[model samples]
Target: MSRFTIPVCHVDDIDHESSKGFEIGDLNFFAVKRDGIITLFQNNCPHLGVNLEFQQDQFLDADNFYIMCSTHGALFQPEDGKCVYGPCQGQSLISVDFEVIEQQIHIAEAATAIA
Candidate 1:
């Protein structure tokens, strides 16, 4: 139940209007940048508990508006990780607590659970 903050990347490392994957302990997570804001989430799809990206660092759809689960096409809003389409329509992506310190992105340590 304890948590720690681990630095993931610099604020500028994340591409504008895109998502980048990172790992903390054994948990996979991703960070999305949109409209000058950064959002973090667990990288697994809610429907099947699988990695969201179809390919490396490809978490967004054609328009880069939402997080898309490449495995099942589940779409989630970037700002809140809320599922807007696909099998887990009413569910949401697990949001990870993060903070920016001196232009660096730090994610709170998460449990080693994969799903």
Candidate 2:
């Protein structure tokens, strides 16, 4: 597997119920904070590769633990980007490696190529 690091957000910039999403290189990344941990996921919904941004950063459910794809109501866990509902079953959002330093997000070269 190609390993890449993305500098995403600051340690103090995110909290539960809130998230930061952005495009790295060839892929969309959603950085979410929950239980004091940060997780990253590719923004493409497996159902059709449509960007989760289609709904204007409204990717989280009201509970804020998973990514909700408004395109077809597919819910995904922020920890692993696994699909919990909708057309794509048993599939998951691609997880990307990332790090947070000085409140900036850096996408590793390999990660950027995917975006």
Candidate 3:
């Protein structure tokens, strides 16, 4: 399959300890920064398959420690996208392959299949 890079944003544009939303084709995703590392995941919450953000580009909890699901309060580890609490428990967010080049966030081409 042919692959393309979807530029999400500049590294500096994302707050030091927060997340921002992006899209490629019809896929919705988000990028998060924590402890100087950036990670990417599909926006859908594992528990309900709904958007994780309660408000626009707001994925982290008040403390900016974990990704909080808007609907059920699920907390996902920023490093591994694992749900540490809430309804999803052992479940994890779906990670999307991404890379930083020239200080720009670029996601791998959207996959044809979801699962």
Candidate 4:
């Protein structure tokens, strides 16, 4: 299906070594920043389609390494959204396609679908 672009946030707005969640229209997504690289993913955990963060913008594990699911304590690789540990092993968080224009983070989504 066709997609539409929605602005999420500025690249610098995410802060270093942290994540931020956003809810735009009907979409739920989050961004993780580490070493100047930002990764975007859908907020839902694959295990039961639950939001990964225990609280707003707190998706990372205690050590600020992998993305941790608040519901099951699942850990995911930040670079690829791969679930490395916990119940949903081998499953992954859904990655959201995004673009940075003039330092603004923009994600493309469809009017009806998230793609």
Best by lDDT: 4
Candidate 3 matches the true fold with a TM-score of: 0.90
lDDT of each: 0.85, 0.73, 0.85, 0.87
lDDT at position 113, candidate 1: 52
Q: Which tens-of-lDDT digit does each residue in 1-115 have in candidate 4? A: 3242677788988989999998887778899999899999988999989888999899999999999999989999999999999999999988888778778887775621572
Worst 10 residues of 3 by lDDT: 106-115
Model 3 pairs whose backbones collide = none
TM-score of 4: 0.91
Which is the winner by TM-score between candidate 2 and candidate 3? 3
Cα lDDT tens digits, model 3, 21-81, are: 8766777888899989999888899888899998899999999999999898999999999
lDDT of model 4 at position 61: 97
Please give each candidate's TM-score.
0.90, 0.80, 0.90, 0.91
Cα lDDT tens digits, model 2, 66-88, are: 68887788888777888888898
Model 2, C-alpha of 100: deviation from truth (Å): 3.9
Judge candidate 4 against the unseen true structure and give its global Cα lDDT, from 0 to 1: 0.87
Clashes of each: 0, 9, 0, 0
Better model by TM-score: candidate 1 vs candidate 2? 1
- Residue-by-residue lDDT tens digits, candidate 1, 1-115: 3253678899999999998998767879898999999998888888998999988888999999989988878899999999989999989988888778778877655543543
